[model samples]
Target: MGIKLDEEKGLTLLEVLLSIVLLVIILTSFASFFTQSAMFVKKNEDKLSTTQTAQQIVNQIEVSLSKNDVKTSSVCGTLPCLLEKKELSNLLGSPITSSFNISAKFADSVEGLIRVKVSVTDIKNPENSSETFTYIRR
Candidate 1:
């Protein structure tokens, strides 16, 4: 009798199929996670961009308010209209929107204090909009 070995070292068909199914499940979950993460990042970025733009708008308005230049116009207009689209675009280094819509609504105005509601909307997507209220003093 020559050398006889009792060893079976190959995976069965069932074992191979089960392992493959497990790997597929794991990989699919990871892929969905990565996809969700990417979406979150994009949405966050858009929000940030809109917020920054809104901040800049508020700052400019505050400055004008100090100089006694803010108007009660509902829509932004040229030169003396309180706000202008081209002017805002010029102030931003990289504008997220080619154009924007600036609208103002007065919440309350009294002596030494004015409550103004302003909305900055991206022309590309209205959902990418920001609103802030600023108080101005006499």
Candidate 2:
């Protein structure tokens, strides 16, 4: 009698193991990609928050200068005045991140202009910070 093929033959153990290994490798790569994407998004959000905070501080300074709310004599006895942190905090309430720095200086230069500089820093991530400045007439 001639040799006959077995119709009931199925996949061997080696074939099943190979498919499982390949699937695991693909899934692991995807997982790492997702993790990296999440980190990037978080960093971007922090940068945006810092930028908005700096802009807000700048706006507040501009408004105060325009309305003459800051009195040179009362706040600073001389030129190149540094605003008290407490006063600025009271004006801005609570910022997105409490860790920030704002500096507004009034110097008697030839132009009689006030320099307002606002900076916001994320204490946790120093790279996430922003600074904005503007000049206004005294």
Best by lDDT: 2
RMSD of each: 5.6, 3.8
Shift in Å, residue 71, candidate 1: 5.9
* Per-residue alpha-carbon lDDT of candidate 2 for residues 4-88, written as tens digits (9 for 90 to 100): 7777588889999999999999999999999999999998988898888777777766655542434434555455666645655
Mind giving the per-residue lDDT tens digits that candidate 1 earns over 1-138?
866556657888999999999999999999999999999999888878777766776666566553243333334222223334554333322233435676544333556465656677877888988888787674
Worst 10 residues of 1 by lDDT: 72-81
**Model 2, total clashes:** 0
Q: Any residue pairs clashing in model 1, and if so which?
A: none
Q: TM-score winner among the candidates?
A: 2
